[model samples]
Target: MKSLFLAILLLTLYGCDNSQNQSKPPVKSENKEQLISPYFGFLNQQKDSLIALPMDQAMESPEKYNYVIIENQVSPLGFIQNKSDNKESNGRQTAQNFANSEGSLFTIKNEIKSGDFGMLVNQAFLSQYKIEPFTKVERETTPEVKEKLEKKYKRKISKSTTVAVLKDQAEFNLTVFENQQDSALAVFSYIKEDQLINLDFPATYDDISTWRVDDGGQFDNEAFQVLTVLRSEAGISFVSIFWGAEGYELNFYQPKKDKFTSAAQAYGYSSPL
Candidate 1:
């Protein structure tokens, strides 16, 4: 009887100890590096290298990458002529001159020869790393949100508004308001938990040239629109495109030290009307 009691007590103690160990939190791997998305890495590489490769390289070696930028949908930066020069010639002439310029990375011959200038990505890289894609949330602007924005900007909001949520960690709100001149001005704000932050555009109103005129001959309002949102385990990137009299501007914003700040910029010339 004494031996049986001792055995039962030992069994109970072992069970309790095993249960406690299982309930403990997982042990994170030491010095585990965060994963960056392949697409984001590719963009960063291009920006850093500043070396444009011929479009035929991807085609000559199709097995080298899973995806290749066959055509440049957006105008490559640094190829467009000065905005001042644009006024001297017709739009078609300016476009033709731009195409023929030696400095231009994209040319009519390149387009005809090999689609367009672009980069290629390897399938193995994508399979090794996983990144979340941005999902578009409803455009419904809540009264609380609207009130917060109105109070912050001290302006009446227009119906042109959009909201996007990223990785369930960040919320973005783009709102437009009419300035004193009755032109559309975009205001971008970010929300995380109880924090509300606004993005200060790097370019001032004075720096931007509004050359496009409306039917009424008034300067066209710039439409600052979000182009893409990329998420990686390391960080989140917000890419936006807007136009001015000069051409299209691409701005890259990323969160750093608790605020979304402009990290990089690219420019593309608009095809003249």
Candidate 2:
């Protein structure tokens, strides 16, 4: 299965004869967005010019091309050489597995220059983990509930602050926390759904610094309700807030700013709970 996975991919993308001669500049009259539609066709058309270089090599001369076609799983580690026989054998297998899942292809335009491009790729490679989606069960935290929560939290809960819950349907107790700073934090804990037995995943904490709640417009500026909380099978979470007349803006809690497995995949969630 692994061999076939990559073999089919390579034959599809890399084995074809260079089709550069058949290529021509896009028609000037064509729509700009549609003109860029046949990016893969361009890849095959410029196959001869498209050097079969590693990512590092491509990064070095990123400006030479307008677009770069990369396999889904290309990593810098694949280019590294290991001297130890055992380590080399393991590395080779790991690299092969990485290459096997080449079901997708994408083109990265030269938006960032050499060093920045390399850094971007490195950051991406680090964040490629399987995410488990959480079930969104939105319940309004009323003023009375807020007062009760203050006793449990031991900190005076503000009337204006909003709160939401995400359950893993197992042994996880995930909650949101907002302080005087107006910054939100995702506090993690493990507890059974029915029994409420705390488990060993242990209580931990992380911040969703990327999401800035905009407090403006004619609506009650203090009322920042989490209108939506989206979870995916990949364990990713997204929160959408009704920021008054500013309407709604979607935000994700990224543990690492630079590392994202699939921004496109995350954006694919059309409906939220």
TM-scores of the candidates are 0.45, 0.23
Report how far residue 6 has shifted in candidate 1, in Å. 54
What is the C-alpha lDDT profile of model 2 across 246-267, one tens digit per residue? 2232222322222222121111
Query: lDDT score, residue 44, model 2?
Result: 18
Model 2, TM vs. native: 0.23
lDDT, candidate 1, equals 0.45
List model 1 lDDT by residue over 1-273, tens digit each: 999999999999999999999999999989643322222111211221111222211223222333322222222222222122334444321223432322213111122222212333344433432344455555756677778878876777764344667667577777655454534455577676666767643221332442232213222233565556555454555566555555555555666754577655544444556
Question: Which residue ranges in model 1 land beyond 4 Å of their true spot?
Answer: 1-132, 136-138, 167-170, 178-185, 201-222, 232-235, 244-246, 256-259
The candidate that achieves the highest lDDT relative to the unseen native structure:
1
Q: Number of clashing pairs, model 1?
A: 0
Residue 78 in candidate 2, Cα distance off native in Å: 21
Query: Could you tell me which residue pairs clash in candidate 2?
Result: 131-234, 131-235, 132-234, 132-235, 133-235
